[model samples]
Target: MVRLRWYRAAPPPDLPVRQVHGFLFAPDGRAFLRVDGARHGLPGGKRELEDADPAATLRRETWEEVTLEIGAPRYLGYQLVVDGGTHRYAQVRMVALITRIHPVAPDLDNGRTYRRLLVDPRRVGDLLGWGRRGSRQAAAARQRAVVEFALPTLDLPPDGEV
Candidate 1:
């Protein structure tokens, strides 16, 4: 069995008090990710709890960005990090059951056009390296955490004790 560790840290005074994220997976074993050209990070956006349920938030973000309707998500867990005395991070994980993917009408809400790419979990190390080289620190760490904690739990090869 794989054991996951959840960490937490206090937040900075200025930033919005709460944050969350989702990890959507496709039936083909590819994981759903967003390419945020504006922030140069993975695709995702802020959520105000009142605006949508956590699962809905994940679906909405995925659809708006990638034009795909992700299936019901299975909540994995969360991580909290305090950094630079300015940002507070809460990274949440969810398994997205991707039923289909295709282009749709342009959405003004999403600042940029995002393309969905199916990624092999085993190649995550290479993805992380690319993110790091691109200076996408948050994206790199998030991908690393997924490889470290999530992928292993799924029973893919190149295993390591979690």
Candidate 2:
């Protein structure tokens, strides 16, 4: 089992960053992108050597997974992953607004055909399967983003409360 705790900013540069994920919003700003198969994860994966930064990893992974072009992502948070009795890795989770998207296709890395899910925040935990702790952390970050950033420009209510 693993536990994920959310933070508002990137971890110190000295810490080892393991993976990056994005809570990608649709054009409506109500729903988010989710991979259809697998564990119902967000549209992201591990950091790659060619990636200039974590954001780049998100961009490449999103495209490879769902053919979505993301705008500048807000640094929503990072997750401290603890497994068994030891600390494992740090996962960065960004909230990106989707600008444009093309047809879905098989992921270049794993050759799995990934479909998209534009789902409500209340349903994220059920769909993403981030477990109890990770899902709670993700839901909190989503709430914060909506209140801080998306609220001004959006007409909808904040997603499922904080």
Candidate 3:
């Protein structure tokens, strides 16, 4: 089984980072979701050679997957992923306070445009189905967004609509 543990620590220098992804919020405080078939997820992917850093990785992946250009990302935390204790790596989580959603286009990697959704903060964890841990991560990111970016967290419909 795969286990994920969240830490509000900086990205590890020694561990191999498998991916970078996280809570991407717009100026209005709505969270961004990438709709794959029926499952909803946050934007992110593995590091690329051209990416300058983890933040750059998130920016490039977000744009590729959702055709959205995100502003400077705020580092939040990292997830320690253990697959049966045999393998381990880090997945960085961050938050982007501003974005410009462009006209939908196919992802550069897959050539298929994914459906994008802007969601309310309250339902992000439920949508992701990552249990309590993801909920806590979302809460932390929301808190950071509020304190650092002045994003009005949860000012959305009760149904978690944008």
Question: How well does each candidate superpose onto the true structure, as a TM-score?
Answer: 0.58, 0.79, 0.91
Evaluated with lDDT, which candidate comes out highest?
3
TM-score of 3: 0.91
* lDDT of model 1 at position 7: 35
> Candidate 2, which segments miss by more than 4 Å at Cα?
1-3, 83-87, 147-162
> Which lDDT tens digits does candidate 2 get at residues 1-162?
866676766787766677888887654555565555465678888898999888998999888877889887777678877788576678888877778878867778878776576656667767766678667756765676576456333364455311
> In model 3, where do residues sit more than 4 Å from their true spots?
154-162
Candidate 3: tens digits of C-alpha lDDT, residues 51-139: 88999999889888888887789899999999998898999999986557688888899897788777787778888888999999988
State residue 72's C-alpha deviation in candidate 1, in Å: 0.9
Candidate 1 lDDT over residue span 1-162, tens digit each: 222224333333343434455555555445444544432223345675664655766677666666777666655445444566555655554445566767644545845565445555445435534343322333343454455445333544332211
Worst 10 residues of 3 by lDDT: 153-162
Report how far residue 38 has shifted in candidate 1, in Å.
12
In model 2, the Cα lDDT at residue 135 comes to 73
lDDT of 1: 0.49
Q: Quantify all predictions' global Cα lDDT against the true fold.
A: 0.49, 0.71, 0.83
